[model samples]
Structures are given as C-alpha cells and as structure tokens.
Target: MLVDKVAEILAETAAEVIEPRFRALADGDVSEKAPGELVTVADREAELIIAERLRGLLPVPVVGEEAVSADPSLVKAVCSEPAVWLVDPLDGTGNFVAGRPEYAVMAALIKDGETVAAWIWQPTTRLGYTAELGGGAWRNGERLRRAPAGGGPAALRGVVLSRFMPPDLRTAVDARTGGIGTLAPGSRCSGVEYPRVAEGDQDFTLFWRTLPWDHAPGSLLVTEAGGVSARLDGDPYRVGRDVEGLLVAADEESWQQVRRELGLRPVDLA
Candidate 1:
C-alpha cells in the first residue's frame, strides 16, 4: 500500500539523514529561513530524500517544507493537484538544534484537498504513527483510540500555541486558561503535539497558524483516533484552506467543553 511505502520512506530518511545530525550540526549547517525561523542541513537533505522517494512511489507533487521555503508557490499544488504530498522533514528544527529530543518527521497525503493518509516519525524514539482516512490510526504496530474524555473543564490539560494570535486574542486566551486543569506553551513542534493529544497525554491543543505541513498529518491522526479537530469556529479542518484558530481534543464532548471554557466563538476570518 502507498501508506505503508510512505511510512518506510519516512523511517529510512530519518535514520539516514535526520538522526545522524541530531546534535552534530556544524556552525554553517544551520541558517535562518526568516528572522527567528531556523532551518538546518538535515532538514534540506531529508526533505530531498523523502520527496524523491515519495515521488518515485506515486509520481505526485511533493510539497515539502524546505522546498516551499525556497519557492512558496510550490504549496499551491496542495489545492491544485489531484494528489499531493505535504512533508515536514524536520519538525522541530529549533529543538533539534538545541540538542532536545522533541523533534519529528511528518507528512500527509492530500487528495482533492483532503488528507487521505498521514505519517509522523520520531527518530529518537523510533516511533512511527500512521493514519488513513478510514483505516484508523496506529503507533508502532498497535491500534490507537484516544483515551475517553475525562474530568471537566477545570480538569482539562492542554497545549495552546498562542504565539501567532493577535494581541487581544492572546490575552483573552491567557486569561481564560486559568479555568483549565493544566496548560502548556506547546513543544514548538506540531509533529510531537498532535500525537501527544491523540494518545491522551494532553487533553487538547490550540494553534493559531494553520500551515498544512504542520497540521495536516496531526489533524488526521487525532480525528481518526476518535477525537475531534476543527477550527475555533467549529468548522471541519480542510487541507490547503486559509483559516486560523484550530482546536483539537480527545473527543467531541471535550472539544465543546474546551471551546466554551476558552470563550471561543466563531470569527469571520474572511
């Protein structure tokens, strides 16, 4: 199956390109793609290796993070192409550069603007997660079902990525978070955050930026595991769309609970 092939490719690339450079980056190996946005040699090399292998397997447009960084127009393929591969070669470049083990390699297969299959591989842990549109999600080899919703709004534990949110919205979210059980600043890696939410390690997650490579894979994983993922306005998440404020939780009930607790209402981003 194509999903299986893609999974193998991600693992192989992580082993051959990503893992070796974990803390071995030279002075010239890392550079800023934008102010404060870092990219490393491993990110570029791994994206090339993964993109090539994916194209070889299916001959489709492969929109990788590093590639899109060089040419933003490449991302348009996600909506225009019949089938496209969205790849994040090194998800947590900052963490990896800092010698932290919280990074991952992530990819999602989008067909007709919807995610069909997804994969996330954490090199340090040798853990791989895959999810198909209807085949459900799995980790390593075990099937995954998000833990049942537990506790109330005050007991909810979550990670909120509010860095990109507008000042007023950020302050609003911060003030509201006091009602939740536990809140985190996020791991700075959607690849890691998505799986943690799916497995119930965290009750929910909120993101202001809706980049396809970052959210596509994880969004499918969480939803396929019997969780809920949608825009803050409660719209279903669609790949390649321009919107903001995503809230993902372990289940529908928890989803609504968090939405209400956070005082989130639908906003017209248009």
Candidate 2:
C-alpha cells in the first residue's frame, strides 16, 4: 500500500537525514526563514529527501513544508492538484536543535483539499501513528479508541496558539488556558502533541498557523480518534482553507466550549 511505502520512506529519512542531525547540527546549520521561524539543516535535507522519494510513491504533487517555504506558489498548487502529499520532514526543529526529544516526521495524503490518509513517525520513540478518513486512527498499528469529552476550559489540557495570537487575544487565551488544565509542556512539535491527544493523554490543542503539512495529518488523526477539529468559528476544518487558526478538542462538545469561552460566535469566527 502507498501508506506502507511512504512509512518506509519516512523511517529511512528519519534514520539517515533527521536523526543523525538531531543535536549534532554543525555551525551555520540553522538559519531563520523569518523572525522566530528557524529552519535547520535537518529540516532542509530531510524535506528534500522526502520530496524526492515521496514523489515516487505517488504521482501527485509533494508539497513539503520547506519546499513551499522556498516557493510560496506551491501552497496554492496543492489546492488545485487532484491529490497531493504534504510532508513535514522535521517537526519541532526548535526542540531538536535544543536537544529536546519532541520531534517527528509527518505526512498526509490530501484529496481535493481533504485529508484522506496520514502518518506521523517519532524517531526518538520509534512510535508511529496513521489514520484514514473514516477508517479510524492507530498508534503503532493498534487501533485507537476515541477519547471522552473533557469537562470544560478548566479541564482542557494541551497546546494553545499564544505564539500566533494577537497581543490582546494572547493575553485572553493565556488567562483562559491558565484557568483550565495546565498546558501540556509543549515539545514544540505538533507531531508529538497530536499523538498525545489521540492517545487521550491530552485534551485539546489550538493553533493559529494552519499549515497544511502541520495540521493535515494531526487533524485527521485527532478527529478519527474521537476528537473534534474545527476553526474557531465552529466550522469543520478543511485542508488548504484560508482560515486564521484552528481548535482541536476531545470532541465536538469541547470544541464549542472553547469557542464559547473565547466569546466567538460562528458568524464571527467562521
């Protein structure tokens, strides 16, 4: 199957390109793409390797995060492509560069702007997650049961989008999340947190950057595992959508709970 083949490539890419460079980055191996947005040698090399090899696994366009950063047009290209593969060669470059162990390789197959299949591989843990639209989610090949709905903001536990939030909104979110369950000490890796959420160890996660390579796979996995993912305005998430950011919950009930806590109605958010 293509997922199996892609998984092999992901494993190989991590073994050869990503793992070796973790905490071993030489001088000049890191540069900022934009302020606070760091890209490392591992990110570039792994993404290049993934782009080269993953493209062979399928005929569709491989819209890798690093590749699209170089050529912004590819983001638009993905929307029109009949099908596309979005790859995040090295998620959590910050943690990896900092010698933290919260990173992974993530990929998703998007057909007509919807995520149909997804995979995430954490090299350090050698743990893997995969999901198929409506086929359910799995961890290391074990089928996952949906996590139950959380209590409320106070019970919500996971990441939030403070980095991408506006100053006032950031303060508000900080206060709101502070009132809730503790924010999971982020590995700064969505690949890490997404699986944590799927396993029901974490509650909800919010993100202001809706990067396809970042959210596509995790979104499907969270939803398939019995969580809910949608924009703040209470709309279902769609790949390549130009929405501001996203909210993921233990279930639809929590999603709306967060939305209400934020004082956003669907008419305003969506």
How high is each candidate's TM-score? 0.97, 0.94
**Tens digits of lDDT, candidate 2, 207-229:** 88788888888989988998888
Q: What is the clash tally of candidate 1?
A: 0
Q: Which candidate is the best by TM-score?
A: 1
Report the Cα lDDT for residue 163, model 1: 91
**Lowest summed lDDT window (length 10), candidate 2:** 261-270
lDDT of 2 at 107: 95
- For all candidates, the clash counts are 0, 1
lDDT of each: 0.90, 0.83
Off by over 4 Å in 1: 268-270
Q: Per-residue CA lDDT of candidate 1, range 1-270, in tens? A: 887888999999998988888889888999999999999999999999999999898899999999999999999999999999999999989999999999999999999999999999999888899999999999997899998677888888898888998888889878988888988778999889999998888989988889899999999999999898899778778987788889999988899998888888886244
Error of 2 at 249 (Å): 0.9
